[model samples]
Target: MADEKIKKVSIICSKGSLEGVYPALIMANGARMEGIEANLFFTFFGLDAVTKKKVKKIKVATVGNPAMGIPTLIGAIPGMSAMATWMMNKKMDKLDIPPIDEFIEMINAAGGKLYACKASVDMFGLEKDDFMDEVKKILTVGEFYALAAGGHIIFT
Candidate 1:
């Protein structure tokens, strides 16, 4: 298996937080960079990463995130989420990590396919126009499975 090349990857993004969303984007971008076909499927809160109105505002979840190294009580304090988000954004910016919107554009430009979950879209009462132009289709789970056939499935 180690010798076999990956032909495709189907990445599922189910959370909207910056921490949740970036992993999927980074994986998809890296896959495309390696010449592997890539598909990003947004569902549940993950739809925020694709939604034009919410994409730019994705924030870190300071509360309940032990990785932040802060107490949950402190994380729950007012403005803590925003402060953590700002600090993280600054660090990422310094590392040259593109913003979420720009990262998605780069992935799309690199030939990675973007998809919205049909069930989630309906649940959220969102339409095609609500998503970025990069989203190629709103797909049912079965349809996404079809597209993912023969590829590795990654749920981030």
Candidate 2:
């Protein structure tokens, strides 16, 4: 592993929530700044991070999140998810973290590639236009793996 130079990184995002998506975006953006080729592939519920409408509003996970200290049942109560999401976003904003759309734009402008999982897109009834304009294409898992060969592959 020490002998290999990391010329590229492919990140797989499988969760849709803000907690899940931001890490992938941060890493991808960081990779490009380091002169490494970066590709972000959004799959399953992670599609929300790439979808034009939902990306900016991706919420924090409240239900089933033990870190929040709320019982799962209580966390699942109406408005709790929104409150958590709002709190997280407020913190992120104060920290100067750009919203998801701006983050994607920055990465794309810096040459990072964005892709959506074809299966997820189909399952969600999303067309190409449903994704952020920066997304290069939608690819199957097999196709994604083939493209991801020869460098580090990270799952977030």
Q: How far is candidate 2 from the true structure (C-alpha RMSD, Å)?
A: 1.5
What residue runs in model 2 are displaced by over 4 Å at the alpha carbon? 1-4
Q: Give the alpha carbon lDDT tens digit for every residue of 1-156 in model 1.
A: 799999999999999999999999999999999999999999999999999999989999988898889999999999999898899989998988889999999999999999999999999999999999999999999999999999999999
- Specify the highest-TM-score model's number: 1
Clashing residue pairs found in predicted model 2: none
For all candidates, the clash counts are: 0, 0
Report the C-alpha lDDT of model 2 over 1-156, residue by residue, as the tens digit: 688668999999899988889999999999999899999999999899888888867888899889989999999899998999898888988998888889989999999999999998999999999988999999999999998998889999
lDDT of 1: 0.96
Error of 1 at 96 (Å): 1.6
lDDT assessment of candidate 2: 0.91
